[model samples]
Target: MTSVLPRTKVSDVLFSCCQLLDISVKWTIQYDSPPKYPHYDPGTSRQLLCDQCPPGSYVKQHCTATSPTQCAPCPDQYYAEEWNSNDECQYCSAVCKELQYVKQECTSTQNRVCECVEGRYLELEFCLKHTECPPGFGVAQPGTPESDAVCKKCPEGFFSNETSSKAACLKHTNCSALGFKIALKGNAVRDNVCQENTDTTPQKCGIDVTLCEEALFRFAVPTQLTPNWLNILADSLPGTKVSTENIERIKQRHSSQEQTFQLLKLWKQQNKEQDMVKKIIQDIDLCENSVLKHIGHPNLTFEHLNTLMASLPGKKVGKEDIERTMKLCQPTEQVLKLLNLWRIKNGDQDTIKGLMYGLKHLKTYHFPKRTIQSLKKVIKFLHRFTMYRLYQKLFLEMIGNQVKSVKVRCV
Candidate 1:
C-alpha cells in the first residue's frame, strides 16, 4: 500500500525541435526507495512482543509488540505498583484481611498469599493447610503450641505447674518425713518435685537442730545461728522457754528445777504468737559475728558453756548427744580453757548469763521446722533459773580434753 514516485531530468532538445535541427535530447528517470525501518528509541523498553515472562513474574497479556518477551507481574502483597503488559500484577504489601496471616512479602507488582491465623489450620484447596480441629475434652490431651496436645487430669497431690505445659500433674510421693505429709504438690506430680514432705521429726528429740540448723538457715546468718544464740534453739525442745522474767532469774541458777519453770512460761507466749516466732527467728539472723577477740578478757570462745546450759533441763538433749556435738567446734580445748578462766574471775558473777549472750552467734539455727509441740517445759525451766558460771567449768571438765580438734573456718 505504500509507494515512492519516479523522477526524470530533461536536456537541451528545445532549440533543435523549434528550428527543425536534428539535435537529440536525453531523459533520465530516478526512483525513490521506501522509508527505512524505524531505529529503536533510546528511552524505549528493550522488550520483545513474543518474549516469555522473566523470573518472579508471569505473563498477563500477550505481546502486540514486535517481541513477546516483554511481560510484567502483579505487585507482591497488596501495595504493588502498576506495570506495562503485565499479566499477573506486581505484588504490594497489604494488611492481611480478616482470616489470613502474612505468609509472604509483596513485591513492587504483586500481593502475597495470607495464611490463616493459628487456631485455624489452612485448607489446601482454598488455602495451603487444613482448618484447626476443635479442642477435645476428657478424651483429648492438653492443648499445645502445635495444635492440641492430649489433655489429662492432674495427678493426686499434684496440680498444674505451668499454664503452657501439656502434661497432667504427676502423682505425689507416697511417704513423707515423720510428723508431716505432702498437702499439695506444685506442677505435674509425675516428677519428684510433686510435693515436699511437710513434717521433719525424728524418733525422739528434734533432729540435732542445734547442730542441724547451721546447715539449713545458712543464707541470712552465714557462719552464725539465729538470734537468742542458743535460746532460739529452744523451739525444737518442745516445751522449752526463756521468758523475759525468768530469763534473768535462771541466768542466776544452775539447778534442774529452776530451769524448767521459766522456759515453760516463755514457750507459752512465743508458741501462740506466729508473728513473734517469725520475728524471733529473724532477730537471731540479725546478730553480729564479732571476731573472737577478748578485749580485757580471754581470747577463747565460751560457746560450749552456752550450749551446755541450754543442754540442761533434760527435756531434750541427752548428755552424750549434747556433749559430742559441741565438742566438734574448732579450737576446742583453747576455747574451753579460756571460757573457764573468764567464768571464774569475771566480776565475781559465776553464771552462764554473760556466756549465753557472748555465744549468741550460733543461736538461730537451733530448731528444726516443726519440732515444738509445746516448748513451755524447757523454756519455762530456763526462765526460772540463772546459769551459774560453774556450769561452764563443769561442762569443760565433763567434755574436758576429750574434745576433738577442728580447723578454723567461717562456718
Candidate 2:
C-alpha cells in the first residue's frame, strides 16, 4: 500500500494473501441469463407461469410470485370435470321426462344420467313401452333401459300360447313320456293336450253322436255340398269315397236340414273309425265363408269379430284360419261369417257372455282400457235390449193382448 504497484501485481498480491489466510473462495461464471416465464404479467409487462386449478374446481384468482392460485369446488347442480382456469362451473342440464327416471344423480364432477322406467325402453330421446310378442312368436331378447325387446317366430317343437314381452317359446309337452295319449297334437302356438288312454277299440273312439248331430244341424248347409267340398271330404277320409253325384241327388230330394243330416250320416257310416264328428267339423271349417254368410247380425261389426277371434283358445283356431282372416279384403262380410263359424265351433253359447270374456282377456294384454270399456258398454246395451223384448212379450202374454213392438234408441 505504501508503494503504488501496477494493477496486475496488486491482484496477484491479494490472491496470495487470501491463500495464506487458509479460507476457501469460489467463483461462479454465468454464460447467459435464465429464460422468462411463458405467462404474461399485465402490471409489470413481464412473463410469468401461474399454477393451474385441479379437477372439480375452478380458479378464482391467478397465481403470483408471493401467493398460489385460488380455487373453489363446484356448487350443487354444477360440475367441472377437468383442470381449468374458468371462474364458474357448468350447470347440469339433463332432465328426465315421462316414463323416465334418473339413473345417476348429478355430482360436482359429473352430469346426470337418465334411463327408462320398468317395462319401457329409450328411443328417439323418449321412453316407450316394451313390445310384446304375440301368440306363435317368442321373446328372442329381453328389453333394457336403452333398447327395445326383440321377437322371433316360434320354431317347430316349440310353442308360445300367449302374448308376452319377456317369456320365451316353450317345448311342447310329450304326452307319451307322461303316460298319456295325445288327444290333440301340438303345433307352434299350442301345447299337446294329453288324455288318459281309456278306449281299446279304434272304431268306437269318437266324439258324442248327439253333439255331432247338433253341430251338423247348426253349421252344415246345402250350399256346402259342392264338388270341391265333396272332394275335400273324400281326401280327409282315405278309406271312404264321397260321390258328388250321390250328394247332388240327396240335396235335390230332401230339405236343406235333412239333406245336411243325411250326408253327414252317410259319411259317418262309411268311416269305420267313426271319428265322423271330428272329421265333419274339420271339413266344415274348410268352408268357413259359407257358414259365416248364412248367419248375420246387423249390430256387430268386424272390429268386434276381430276381438272375439283374438280371444279364442289358441288350439281352437288353425294356422290357415289366422292367415285367411289377415288377407280378407271384404272385412265386413268375412268378419260376420267368421263370427258365425266361431259360434258353431264354440257350441252356440251366449254371444254376449263370450264377447265379455273375450274383452276381459284382451284388456289384460292387448287393447286399451278405454276401448275395452266402450265395447263392454255396447254389449250391455244389446243385452238390455234383448231382455226388454223378452219382458215385453211376457207382459203381453199375461194380459192376453197382442205383442206390440217398441222402438229403442241407444245413445
lDDT of 1 at 171: 37
Q: Report lDDT (Cα) of residue 34, candidate 2.
A: 20
Off by over 4 Å in 2: 1-55, 64-67, 82-85, 199-411
lDDT of all predictions: 0.33, 0.54
TM-score of 2: 0.37
Q: Write the per-residue lDDT of candidate 2 for residues 191-272, one digit (tens) a residue.
A: 7775544453121222222222333342333233443443333344344554664465444445444454445555554453
**Candidate 1 residue spans exceeding 4 A from truth:** 1-55, 60-68, 73-86, 90-93, 97-104, 108-150, 153-168, 174-217, 220-411
Clash total of candidate 1: 110
Tens digits of per-residue lDDT for model 1 on 8-56?
Answer: 2222334323321110011011213211222233335543324333333
The lDDT of model 2 is 0.54
C-alpha TM-scores of all predictions: 0.26, 0.37
